[model samples]
Target chain A: MAAYVQDAIMLLGDSLTQGGWEAHGFAQRLSYVYARKLDVINRGLGGYQTDWAIPVFEQIFAKEHEQHHVPKVRLLTIWYGANDASPAPSPQHVPRDRYKTNLSHLIHMVTSPASAWYSPDTRIILITPPPVNTYQWDGRVFDATKSYAEAVKEVGLKENIPVADVWTEIWEAAGKDEKSCERFLSDGLHLNAAGYEIIFNTLIKIIGENYPELHYDKLQNVFVPWSEVNVADPRPSLVKRPAMIGLAQL
Target chain B: MAAYVQDAIMLLGDSLTQGGWEAHGFAQRLSYVYARKLDVINRGLGGYQTDWAIPVFEQIFAKEHEQHHVPKVRLLTIWYGANDASPAPSPQHVPRDRYKTNLSHLIHMVTSPASAWYSPDTRIILITPPPVNTYQWDGRVFDATKSYAEAVKEVGLKENIPVADVWTEIWEAAGKDEKSCERFLSDGLHLNAAGYEIIFNTLIKIIGENYPELHYDKLQNVFVPWSEVNVADPRPSLVKRPAMIGLAQL
Candidate 1:
């Protein structure tokens, strides 16, 4: 009964979405759980910061319009900011002020003249990045996740958009289980399948509460167990049953 | 001059480098232009077929090594295949492949095994994808690039790599305003940057050949023109200037 269920949902984030895990990772699960109804597009790049995300967004919008003839974006869930916290190769990061600037620009792009070719009724959901586990320190002092989370929250508040504080939830979750930090993140930064599941569920919950029309059924309840999900090599094969399960099967 | 430059050189290739661009790509360019104080690492992701580049290489490698301790992969260049010739969103498009595999695996991870960990011998380069501009356009084709160049060769091949083909060179270059359509690419297939440059240089020779190595010059005369370098954003302010550039300036 989610409101945005009928709308095309675009998941815009960084590595989290890009690394489609087994049963987790919000995008994959959402597509599986929702199947057939929601036209979900996972436009996530692995090591991208907001700066890079901007251009990607532009390109995606352009392509979508060119191909589909749909101008306005219906719903966008943006989970970025991790890469922005560090001095990575692409220089896609933006320090606090710049981060805010970039976030605002993204908002404007989806809602303003630049995105005029698209739908005006776009609802943007900003998900704060999950916390970085301090268990594996790489010598940087500040918690990149926390700093980025705060920046995202600031933007959500200023923009009057719905914000999901995934950072606090993850921080507390990791804090409770100090022994298994690896459970949450495969790497210190990126989330594993389990971590993605937690995120996917959280987003589902948020969407269910906020937008009732989405009709997001709990995939765990409706679909087969994760073990039977048929995660064979994603490579397209000639065999009839390649141990692979498409989103429709979910 | 010196037994293949002490500086690390990356001789990246696809199944094509497995073929050979001989006079056109980074291999030939380094032979002529680069100073003989560098070493090259030819980490070609052969038969790699786009979407598999990152997850198969960069990510796993990043996880295996420590950041600073990793070898200095000072000079890295890659030329992938005519293999990613599938349909759009069907695991063949460059952007999707980059998002799913290449960029995440290679570009994002700072500690990529493919990189020259702390060896002071690291540098990254991307080559443009070879052209696939010609095919039997019977509307029965899944990937035109596979035959002529639209496959997953535009982005990483064009943007991330230092030297590139991007297919247009042979596409437009061969006919001399006559649209030969078939001369440059063998089987409408691969060519190194050299082949591309044969066309690229013909179009913009001065800018293509000589430009200062503004960023990393520890291994001088290894100049990759700024214009030729296509990153998502190559603006001066976006990235942290490499320390070598500062030293070189001093």
Candidate 2:
């Protein structure tokens, strides 16, 4: 009935996309901005890794395709890898080799001919995991988040998919203000509402340029609160601790 | 510093657990009731099935053991299997066998030695998927919800897990009241705030008996108004319709 097919974007990731902080996360924001033309389905789990996401892709998305006439998902955004860096029991870390394998598998599933629901025209966007703030590292291997992000970028390049380097953006932004890194994260790992806004704006810029017809203007702006965004103070000096025993204590 | 280990009750499931309804659903209510004694972590995702929940378990609970120094979760309540039965493409219905397999996998994961972070005393409660009111049917597979609920019950029996038959309770209450059923469900599938209250009360009755030490009495009662709860209208004869004139009269 229309000149062009409607765009349906499937957001697959962890807690970041799940609208944790007041339901104003990037996924909901993007939905608002592109509401008229784009149908966005947020399939994000709060604590999930690439390996876990793989099974979800199979169980939920694959299963959906097998059962119903699912609408063609034009854009597939894979934003994961945060939890993978954490020290965990599942051993589902984003090791370089495993990361590549997982990314390739995901791309294959969406672009494969066997995937009746997915078309060749479907555009897949791979977003690197965000940088972990220093506060998140309570003696854990939080620094490995960078390695995971690098691995994701490698896979994106090898697979010829568009990659959004969210890691670099956040890292650069934090480099200027080391004191407030912890505030950007809700639980030292996952992004709070403010962090989600940064990612949302980055995504809009990328998607808007590629698909101008999406008319992203219709959706509501989620990240315009530049002044109100509070960054947490990361320094112990800034903390108002109770005064320790002084000379007066004798 | 405390006498016994601090009890942590983790609620894992779909929209029902996510408190899709208005009054913060059962978990929030329970948190208030238990207050300081129990730390209630709500790990609910809207539209999540049992298969999807398994991965989340691996990330949030299983992975952060050594870092957090949190010894173990005292209790876990898993409520899922709703989205699995809703309409789909190839496997429109979750074959009973596959459903059982998924449930068993979940139970095994929780009880197995692999879950070392959780104490052996960790109690797992499996809740039967709630009923789908016939009146709420949007001409889809609303009838299939009963079978899905049955599948969950069978899994609970086989796994030797505590089962809360919410389906039976709700279905019996909505019997013969089609309009009442419609009012309860926001869609034919998910509950509105009012619908969650019925589930919350049912869960409290079961949990209260098992863990009296948890102390649910102090929780503020966030009851839905009687006018809000759906009650069926029996009289269909009072309706008026437009008169149809015969072609001869025209």
Candidate 3:
């Protein structure tokens, strides 16, 4: 069994989030930078919408009693708008109003003390889905997704959660032209490496600005550096320590 | 807190393994393929030797009594020898005999029934360190490193564990030319994307042959596919399921 040696950064949402494990994707980049500091637990379910995600989140996020045994989720990224923005009649679609409610509900599951999954230590950053390239795919409308992205920001504001508004960031990167989004979107829906690079950079900047303590540069490896390991008496030095560089250690 | 929804593949070793979280590295590739089926927990500590790793492993691997509370380690890859091959007098150096013993000790910690961390479900693959480009770096000697690689093979043979002979694979890929190995190695020490690609493919092949049941293709997602979810009553469908496709389910 894997032990709770390090806390985790859990990425939760749809295909956009699941694809974060791809090379050069945001999740992979985060894992590389936060290598020894935190484990990246990807709870991204491809093709999932906020409506369907609520129940899944309930099961995946440990209840209060189970928390003592599991790794703490130091950071949580809830990125969902993409699939939920699908036009009505598409099974993946969640109405914009309901989408906002679902996002908030997911957030409160951790932020609200009354909820079974509450964890005050878990800092969250909500992400708005990237812009769609209408010319490349017809599964979604550019405007509809834009509305869903807008809905996400509203929820973030109401919940006081930091938002990684990749939708607007990608839109401007594409010169506000939907077709130009092809440079970032592989199939007009999913992201390419270049697209994910933007998400990774945007996310890191958000971490630095809002949760600087959790920044990779600010955290230490849970295990001591090789040179620092006491060679003559290595066992004591080898025990896993907290990743945080406390004032005492400093 | 993160719930244990999936089993895991734990990668344990030195810088070579730590670097696996980098883009296009073996860890990222495995996480991509095994996305929903199994979470990839990286326990790779940089600049670590088999000697330093044992104590670290004791804390990072859950003991038998604690196993029920944590995620099962379905697969483990022990890749060491790069730093240990450092010449005598270097702090990182472990005599060839002791290096072999340390490697076996790590395997036995999980495989031995009487061991505290014993986990019979965890299948292990022993990976030989990639061939070093002696012309580009003087930290290690080519022949000395080759001897360490041979030692890993001996350990795997004696332990009856599968070995991902990446040393031979990378050497042959470099046309057996020391300087040409720069094509795969970034600084003649750590691997480049091309080098990691070889490790990923070779490891996959070993898994296919030795532990076919654990392959990503054979394992179902712990969560139901969106299309298969019982939409009206998703709570039942959303409950976490084992990744294995049982005979009845098939």
Candidate 4:
């Protein structure tokens, strides 16, 4: 069984977030840096949208009563809108207004004191879907996706959550040219290594700026480093310790 | 808090295993394939040996009483021996005979029903240490490390556990030439992407051949695939389901 040794950074979204496990992807990068500090849980469901994620999140996120039994979600990145921006004919599509409401609902499930899944210790970050490269995939509209990205920012502002605006970041990275975004998008929709590099960097910067205490650099390895291990009697030092710097074990 | 939606593949080992979170490393590859099917929990502590690991594993691996509260560790990979092979002068060194005993003890902790941490559902795989290139690094002797690798295989056989002979695999891949292992190893000790590719492929092959039920291909996503979702009434379909194929929810 997987014990609750370390708190976790949960990434919740669609294929974009699921694909974060790819080599050089944002999830992989976070896992590397947070190796002994925090576990990164990728909850990204491919081809799913805000509407569908609502029910799934409810089942995956432990409620207040179940807190002690599970690992604390110290950091959560809600990256959606990619599938929600799909055309009207697509089942994945969620209208911009509903998308915003769904995003807020997911956030409130943890942030709201009255909610069943209230977790005051969990810090939330909202990530806008990357700009769609319509030329590469005809499944989505460029302007439509851009509007959805805008909606994500608006929700972030209202919810008072930090937002990693991947849309604007990639848009600017591509010099605002839609076709040029191919450099980042693997299939006009999902991100490639270069695109994930941008997401990882932006996400880390946001973590450093907002949740500095949770940054990998600010934390210690849950176990003492090798050289620090007491050779003659290591059991005392080998016990799992808290990663938070200067924080005594509870 | 993270709910126990899917079972997990827990990797327990040293830096060689902790480094698996690196780009193209075994951990990342496993996470990608097992995305929704299973969660990959890396309990890899860098610079750790079996001596130090026993205590840490006791704390990290859920005991019998705590099993219901945590994710079921369907597959557990026990990879160690790199640091333990250090020569007599080094504090990390654990003699070959004692090393074998330690490995067996770790296995018994999960397999032995009498043990406090006994977990019948957890399947274990033992991986030997890679060959050391003395020309590149003086920290470990080539023959010394080879003996340790041999020790792992002996333990695996004595315990009737499958062994992923990484030592022999990489050594053969290097054409029995110690210096040529540089292609796989980043430094003389750590693995690079190429080295990890070999580990990932080997590990997956072991899973496929020995534990096909737990293989990524045979398992279904905890949540139904997006295309299969019931569009009109998705809540019933959105619930987290077991990943084992043809197996009804318990």
> Candidate 4, TM-score vs. the true structure?
0.99
After aligning candidate 3 to the native by TM-score, how far in Å is the CA of A98 from where it should be? 0.6
Error in Å for residue B145 of model 1: 39
Residue A230's lDDT within candidate 2 is 25
Worst 10 residues of 1 chain A by lDDT: A238-247
Between prediction 2 and prediction 4, which has the larger DockQ?
4
Per-residue lDDT tens digits for candidate 4, residues B175-212, read 99999999989889989999998898899889989998
B1-250, model 2: which lDDT tens digit per residue? Answer: 0111123577777666665313335654554344323435555656555545554455445432332333245567778767667666422234557767877876776677665433454677777777665456553455566777788788888888767777777666777454566555777666765566677677777766765433345321111111222223312311111111111110
Report how far off residue B180 is in candidate 3 (Å): 1.6
Model 4 lDDT tens row, A1-250: 9788898999999999999999999999999999999999999999999999999999899999999889899999999898999999799999999999999999999999999999999999999999999899988899999999999999999999999998999999999999999999999999999999999999999999999998999988888898899999899988777888776672
* DockQ preference between candidates 3 and 4, better one: 4
**Best model number under lDDT:** 4
True-vs-predicted CA distance for residue B73, candidate 1, Å: 38
Assess the local accuracy of residue B91 in candidate 1 as a C-alpha lDDT between 0 and 100. Answer: 40
- Per-model TM-score on C-alpha atoms: 0.42, 0.42, 0.98, 0.99
Q: Whole-model Cα lDDT per candidate?
A: 0.48, 0.56, 0.92, 0.92
Off by over 4 Å in 1: A1-7, A21-23, A62-73, A87-92, A113-118, A137-142, A176-180, A217-250, B1-250
Candidate No. with top DockQ? 4
- Residue A135 local lDDT, model 1: 66
Compose the digit string of candidate 1's lDDT tens values, residues A60-82. Answer: 45332442322124467888877
**Docking category of candidate 4:** high
* lDDT score at residue B2, model 1, on the 0-100 scale: 8
Global Cα lDDT for candidate 4 = 0.92
